[model samples]
Target: MANPPAVTVCLAGNVGRYKSSLPVGQLLLRGIMAGAYIAVGAALCTVAGTGVAPLLGAGFAKFIGGAVFPVGLIAIVLTGMELFTGDAMLGPLSVLQGKIGWGKVLNNWLWVYIGNLIGSLAYAYIMVWGPFTQGALGAAEPNAFGLNAVAIAVGKTLAYKSVGSIGLWSCFLAAIGCNFLVNVAIMLGITAKEFIGKFFGIWFPIMAFVATGFEHCVANMYFLPTGLWITQLFPSLVDKSTKAADGTVTYWSPLLHKFGGLTWGDVWLWNIIPATLGNIVGGMIFVGFVYYFAFRNEFPEDLMK
Candidate 1:
């Protein structure tokens, strides 16, 4: 058996209340765990999707990445860790339900977001020195996975940088689409009564967002830095040139040539900041507000009490 719509909404708001009431230490700790868990999924997607595009085609590669990408979210949901994107919806919903104030919601978001960033950066550092590189940290060459990380980073940031404001708008739109699906998955997770049901409930929408090429801020926190670290460590890899028999340059990585390399500015300016703002709107307004209004009248009086 599953929760009815009204019951699920009430439960979600209650969960939000509980989350917002957590101590700062607990919030940060859980946030870190959630961030690492998400990074684990992102890493798996990267490794799993490697070399798949050319053989199975881009669509299949996307499907494969999407299919594996939900593992982190599943872990977070089941274990009760804090994720900023989910909190973006949950905290606001709690506020709407009068279970918490905006201040509490903001506090939760701030600490959780910081924790998520710290965890992501930590995991990215681990990945850079571990699987992504084959040798000692300082002298290592980026393995195939590392190269792919660089490419992924470049695509996420520089691709947007190339086009300026329109690119930022595009990223913002993609982020809204991302967190919208993410919170939909969160709602399904709450609605399901059984583990298997919850698993599939969360899986599909998360998969859809990733497969559809939407921008997710938390996921990008891991993706961008992993790529940036690789490129920064191996500066020569930033731009590769293919020379003809006559020693004339025939090919260069278009992104590397155009933008040079991923920078902190590019990562924040082009992707993360816009993506974060868009995620807030997507989750807080699209899912949180919409669902609360839809179900507010029907919530059991006992739930409110």
Candidate 2:
């Protein structure tokens, strides 16, 4: 994060002997910040799914959830923020090239992970408030992006593990492919520094992931919990003959009636945690660190020393 202690300078004793460190806490903080950025992007996409998306009706609504994840990730990369999944690649690279010790990668992973959860929760709060209070996006009488959005997310999430359990590595493979594009998206957005260049950079991966049905870790952060929140907050989003202090609270029961006994736990247990883990593994070990091994030649000579 702080330029990897400048391998050349440290190795040369330019500033006296120094050791490379991951400083677990710092990596965690970066992860948290990255997560918050991602959560915001998730909320934006949710709003788009409910109302007028930034890209307009051009993108598919369901894929809109997935699309927003990378869009948010690319922005974080462009902004030079850290993310766990992307870190997975970088962390390993650092270790393999001797830029940082193995201890650092583990520390970095722990921090980013905790931070990612905090960011995800923050996004959920904004999403519930957006449609509930302002009706900002011109949602339907029963907004799918509202209560229905969660339900659909729950269904989509389970499909992955259920398929995975049947020995379908499609989801696992998809996760890897998503990383290649995801990293590329970050590369373009972060380094390209042009709107269309960055946008087009993201466009190809975003489209490819959608077209090929790749698994994304961050989108699930918003989608799965948001679904549970929808189930939890369903009571809050109802229309009232008389508006009270608790319109959303009132809506939950009746929506359950309409949907036939939906439970919030189902979203959490069957969908959220598994999908979240899949996403984490996909981002960290699968995608992130793998690249580290592949690109050891790019490192500064100090690291080699």
The candidate scoring highest on TM-score is 1
lDDT of 1 by residue, 1-305 (tens): 69999999999999999999999999999999999999999999899888899999999999999999999999999999999999999999989888899999999999999999999999998998899996655664577788788878887889888888999999999999999999999999999999999999999999999999999999999999999888888877756777888988743357876677778988899999999999999999999999999999999988875
Candidate 2 per-residue lDDT, tens place, 1-305, comes to 11232332222221111211435565556666788787776666556556444446535665665555456766665565667666655555445554566666666667777777777767766776665334433333336456445544544544443444542355446656666666545434433435666677666666566445555565556666666555454543333223467663444334334444344454454444454455556554654455444454455664465
Index of the highest-lDDT prediction: 1
Would you list the C-alpha lDDT of every candidate in the order shown?
Answer: 0.91, 0.54
What TM-score would candidate 1 get against the native?
Answer: 0.97
Error of 2 at 31 (Å): 2.2
Q: Could you tell me the C-alpha RMSD of candidate 1 in Å?
A: 1.4
Off by over 4 Å in 2: 1-25, 50-70, 132-144, 160-164, 167-171, 187-199, 210-212, 235-305
